[model samples]
Target: MLRLLINIFFLSLVQGSVAGSEPYFSLADYDAASDREYIGAVGILSRPDLGLVITITVQSGGALLLGDPPVDKIPSTAVKRAVCGQVISFPNLPERNLVCR
Candidate 1:
């Protein structure tokens, strides 16, 4: 019974990994698209100890760059962070199913 369970667990892990590795983006549509047009993206904001992630595309500027690309220091040209804490003072980010454009 123990060996059976172990095999099942490993099988499930392999299945999950394969699914995640599949391309989620559609190349045909992306190629046809005239522009990326700020569809929406996920970004991580870092504080002293923790980080917050959100999906948003409706900022003053259309293009929203996800986490500062894990920089050693925040770049001067970097856009403001969304906020990474229990109490977020930033504006409300649109939830899933809501289109950013």
Candidate 2:
């Protein structure tokens, strides 16, 4: 039992170190907007070397306008990146421009 416990502790230490060594990327901000007629989402992506990236997407509910509006849109869902070293904002969209730092 003692030997097993020591091995388990060492394994846990190694795993913790490995996990901490890698850089982590996370979504800084996420929001959704709707006027009861249209829906949109915005997200901010952040990383160590990569600057902030703002992403915006809109989905129309067709003519029927069925289903509830989405509330969980995240930055990772964005497939396009704004221009480097600049902030771009849309006049009509609710999300502000993504500013690269």
Candidate 3:
């Protein structure tokens, strides 16, 4: 049937062009190294029951800047990059400097 309709239109155009084409985070770059940016931040990773919304996004150079829904609204729920760096800004976790656990 026409090569299965051209292989389902090339697998739906390669799955809709890689579905949103991953790769987002970019807080200018890196941040946490061992907490101190405010006595809070040591490789972010928190889940007092999904208390904090924003998920993951951490480079490894310095500075760190880029807010307002930039780093693709950070969200790595599976818990890989392992983050919870002494943060405080969920309901009242405030004391921020770094976040992404």
Which number leads on TM-score?
3
Question: Model 1's lDDT to the true fold?
Answer: 0.27
Q: Best-fitting candidate, measured by lDDT?
A: 3
lDDT of 1 by residue, 27-87 (tens): 1223224423323344322233422232223222232322223221121211222231122
Model 3 Cα lDDT, one tens digit per residue, 1-101: 54345334323322122313333222222345643242222233244564433332333433221222213233333322323244424232234544332
Better of 2 and 3 by lDDT: 3
- Off-target runs (Cα >4 Å) in candidate 1 are 1-49, 58-101
What local distance difference test score does each model get? 0.27, 0.28, 0.32
Q: Residue 99 in candidate 1 has what lDDT?
A: 15
Instruction: Return whichever of 1 and 2 wins on lDDT.
Output: 2
Off by over 4 Å in 2: 1-50, 60-89, 93-101
Q: Could you give the candidate ranking by lDDT, starting with the highest?
A: 3, 2, 1
Ten contiguous residues with the weakest lDDT in model 2: 62-71
